[model samples]
Target chain A: MAHADMDTQRLDLPEPMPQPRFQAGFITPYAFIFPALLVMLGGLLYPVFMAMYLSLYDWQIGLDLEDAPFVGLTNFSRMLTDPQVWEVLWVTMRFGFWTITIEMTLGVALALLLEKPIRGASVFRTIFILPLMVSPVVVGLIWRYLFDARVGWINYYLGAWFGIEPQIWLGDAQLAFFAIVFTDIWQWTPFIFIIVIAGLQALPSEVVEASTIDGANWWQQVFLVKLPMIKSILVIALLMRLIDVFRGMEVMLIMTGGGPGRSTELLSLHIYNRAFETQQLGYASAISVLLIVIVFAISTLILTMANPMKSRSDV
Target chain B: MTGLFKKGVGALAALTMSTTLAFANPYEKYEGTTIVVSWPALSHFIKAEELIEEFTEETGIEVEVDALQYLKLRDRQLLEMSKDEGEYDVVSWVVMWKGEYVSKGLLTPLSQFYTNGSLVDPNYDINDIADAYLQNGGIVGGHKGYMPGKSGAMYGVPFGAETSILAYRKDIFEEQGLEVPETYDELRDVMAKLHAAGIPALTSRGKTGHQVTAGWLLHLAPLGGKIFDDNWNPVINSPEAVEAAQVMREVVKTGPAGIPTFGFGEAAAAFLQGEAAMHLDTLKIAAMSRDPKLSKIDGKVGYALHPVGSRCGSETGGFAAGIPANSQNKEAAFLFLQYITSKAGDQRMVELGGDPVRISTLQNNTEGFDEYPVVAEQLPCADPDWRPLIPEWNELNIDVLGQALTQVITTDDPIQPIMDAANEKARAIMEREGYYVWQ
Candidate 1:
């Protein structure tokens, strides 16, 4: 066999063919991953870099490229002085705070209330989650028509069924803020509810049974045992809501158009208005940059509170 | 494994295909090919796109339509011109950016088109166009502005024009023992009566910026405040202007419940559905308010000028179209703009929601005009101030006016602060643009 193999060597050199730098393992893995890395860098990282770069320049979107006068941090400084910017930010924060707080409270309550498989609980759960499925714009439009002072179904009832003054739901600043907050809570509470309910269901029966054996009441069980166990899930849910809160201006833009006085003007809507309507592209970009920072900082805080990586590894 | 790889590649390819961004048309060929013109979110552009097939048959040119928002369109215009790149052959510039659009080195001069007597399609008369529109408005960016086009250096000729007229519910007016308010005082009295009757008198502005600026502020401020001085310092936010804004606030109080929250579309809907007793807008909405297809109160609408204060007249708010300096099809775009601006185009629009400025259109009694006496006389009666050329106007209107208007309309806060802020901003913007900027 050795003699036959030696004969079959043909024209082999004494040093033999040098092995490739990497056998299939290292090279093959990178070959598999390179396209993905390229995509991440190109799509996500590039835009972020561009947005940050643009934030520094006094740039208009459609103006001459040569015309972007670099104003250093003046755009950012102007934003700090701009009352409208701060007002819009305040509106956004209030909107986010109300929507998330109410949503979280109601969501947990509903999930706990319905966790027990009672008659028609499934149907009720299905109905509860339905509003979340509808598009935000559709939701806004529906609410808009419903809230119309003259023609809305809401006003019709106020006029006919009850002797209530027709509230300008989308007009007066306070009412408009409440209207947006209520609309958001109505749509998003189900998301929290669904997550919490799932977390409740996943709890070990032994833990529950042990709690029952200890003569702990239902309220105590929920607050003490169940809530502590599902804190991480709750945190995740809150984090998601926080992300959405930053981007919550679309519904307001459609419903109220950021009007009756910048009452409903959230940061996002303000940025959009400045960018498109005003053509102050540089100012708009700076605001957009601020918005990104705000959203990122808030999101980071929320995520760190949950620390899913830390919590999940232990679990 | 091969199939998986192929599927991944295909998915990536599809993603790339879907997002192929619009690029400059390098080809300057103007064969029997059709090109499209567009306006910011109006129905005319939609119809224009639909008619491309017919145009293709007659002219053998391929055309398409693009309907963008007003701000988006303006941005597109500046960008396309800066690159001197043409992607479209026609554009809709109704009553838009002022004559300085010609002076700013942005547009191609149509003086040659005018001299050649090919200014319009033969079926359309060149004489019928309002003289002011031709003389004053036709200038832009240091050139004698040509009519609006899809691409080229020329600005767009109006495909349509809009001047706000009072739209009132006839039933409510009759029941309230009121005639259409012809003057500001009468409008006030009539609106108060309507308010007493528990009917919303108007559908005021909230969502959109220009809606209130044009429909409300421009209307009242011109009547009360000094409109255009000998020196073109716009003092529309003067004490008189404040009085007018206050009047608007008071008047808007009687409008639909969410009036301050309403944009044009909502306001129109509210009026058409008999929610608002009156709406102040152009004849363009006359068709919509009359169309049984959409309007609930079709033919139940009436018209009059928005109540004038001390002044004898009204200001105009109209869109304009222009070609980008970089258009690949300059000649074709120019032809398209001229064609659309001519009588034939106006008449065609007359059948649709066209607000014709041609004398012939008003004289001929277009379809809806014969039904209403005011329509017959209205087109010619409109005041012309598509006004003195202002360069910094883009910033003035969009940044200064729009911002203040939004602040006022949306929040019921101090109008003074917003107005003052706007005035300051407007001054800065105007000064930046090298206009006569007063502190």
Candidate 2:
């Protein structure tokens, strides 16, 4: 009898209202998006296409594009065996690994520690993000001076406090690499903090309440519920940082100039040195193409692990 | 009385007309034309900037100066010159680029302008410029398309030609009873003595790339090392070259606390601050050493010709002014070029803290030529081929030899192996660039 009553109630409900439809023809939506599509094509796609085209020629810096010899795949073949190319790539990978690993760990740890409402919480958050506000070039200069062997405050303080001897920070190969890695981490850790904190704060309240009611401990709740929910955000932050690591090198360029014999020369800096320092534009373009491929592959792999485009249940 | 007054008025009017005709501005025809100049932000160019207003007032041609950092100046000029319509009417280039610019046809030959009497001032004596600066900066189109030669076409006018000189502390030398070193062995002994007496003996540029290569070249030529032979083969691994590298390594040992990372500015500062006893680099350092505001030991600095090794060869390199081939205001640009490099302009350039390229200016400018004696003595020894002027030189200098030098100075590695490695890479690049085609 209850089932029959439920069925009769469903049947008696008012007919569903018809969905609204656009009165204009199909051209309306296309017209609305045309400007954005044009921007993407011109601003984003054009340079990438030009790089690909130029990579096929043996073009030097001063020559006209028409006069450039059409040496198909010669630049690419050269890149495959160029020892400097491999060395810089190896350096970039090592740099990316250390910086990203530490940044992710520290960023998440700090976010979780300060995610709650507390005394001066906003002030702490602002202070934590200050390094992100500084320009990379300015950061490089500041760190370079601080790391100077003779006049730097770092040497001064070490001597004053502990009587440690002053070291040539940028002159040594290992130290230069360490200095650059430390600088990158100092500048970029805040980005991950911002993203991860936002994701942590946006979790639905009821789920946490249910978990608490089930007698979950703080550690259990964080590990099993909060972290699982914010996995996608963490992946995205990691991907962004990885991309930045490959693209940005101004700090290293200004600090060490990829020196102490290219110990800190990342792939981007290598491409820059090859392009401007050596005046081999076509060879540099080939290296850039390789960089773009590597970045694209890494992004694709990360996105597959945590697809943000998936529906909520799927996520 | 009326007739006498009329005759006086007629005479005065005729005198006024003749004076006005005699003093007419030669550049008045190009009035209202605005030409842009691209220059490096070196001390010389910035000092020369003070005279731009004077140039404009005289020529009635407005001038816009684009003073860029030394490293960025070439990139900016290359970009401008590559365009069909260039923005820079006048451009300044360093010695290393003279070959590339002329070979690429980016510069207009000054010979044509000089021969065309209408474009050149009749009083402009091209021969008055020093042969070292003129041959290095002006001549191109020889061996490998850019080597300095007498038979080559004249492309640019030398403006800031510089040669290296050895600077030492007069007071310190007198206190120690030291004689000015004239040879490499003497230099080493004197430097070791100074170092043992608790004074850093030398300050020089070693901060990789061109900085390191430039200082090494100071020793390279004097120590009997040449980058290449007559056949364009890299001889950097030769016995004399290895000796040069070893000598540089020893010099770095007795240099300032952080000598390996010092650029020109830092090296200059070390000497000015009295942290070091000697500097063997550009003659411009002499001017800086005498500036009371810049130096702590201003009148205490002494100048000498570069120390001799197997032979005496001083560095000859600096800037030159050129007109871009695509410049829209070629005549105006040439006029600007001529005005700044003339006898009076060269003197004024020295007064305003710029290096002089003219022989007469160095001799005649008593008020500004403080280092005139030593520089004049050093001029004849200036070697135009101090470093190779080929386009491939950038790679050889920066990527191979420069990086190898950075390695050599920073590490205690075997010098021969590092130089040999650099030699192999240089050979490879030259082979690829067709420098070995004759072989």
Per-candidate DockQ vs. reference: 0.27, 0.55
Q: Highest lDDT among the candidates is held by which one? A: 2
Q: For residues A1-315, write the lDDT of model 2, one tens digit per residue.
A: 999999999999999988657555767889989999999999979989989999999888778999999999999999999998999999999999999999999999889998999999899899989999999999999999888877889889999999999887887788888989999988999999999999989989899889999999989988999988888788788889999989998998888888877798999999999899988899999999999999999999888867765524565
Q: What share of the true interface contacts does each candidate keep?
A: 0.56, 0.47
Error of 1 at A68 (Å): 2.4
Tens digit of per-residue lDDT, candidate 1, span B145-259: 3223343233445455555556677778888788887777777787788888888786666444555665455455445564345445566567766666665676577777666
Q: How do the predictions measure up, each by TM-score?
A: 0.83, 0.92
Q: Which portions of model 2 show Cα errors greater than 4 Å? A: A1-29, A209-215, A311-315, B1-25, B291-293, B366-369
Q: In model 2, what lDDT does residue B113 have?
A: 76
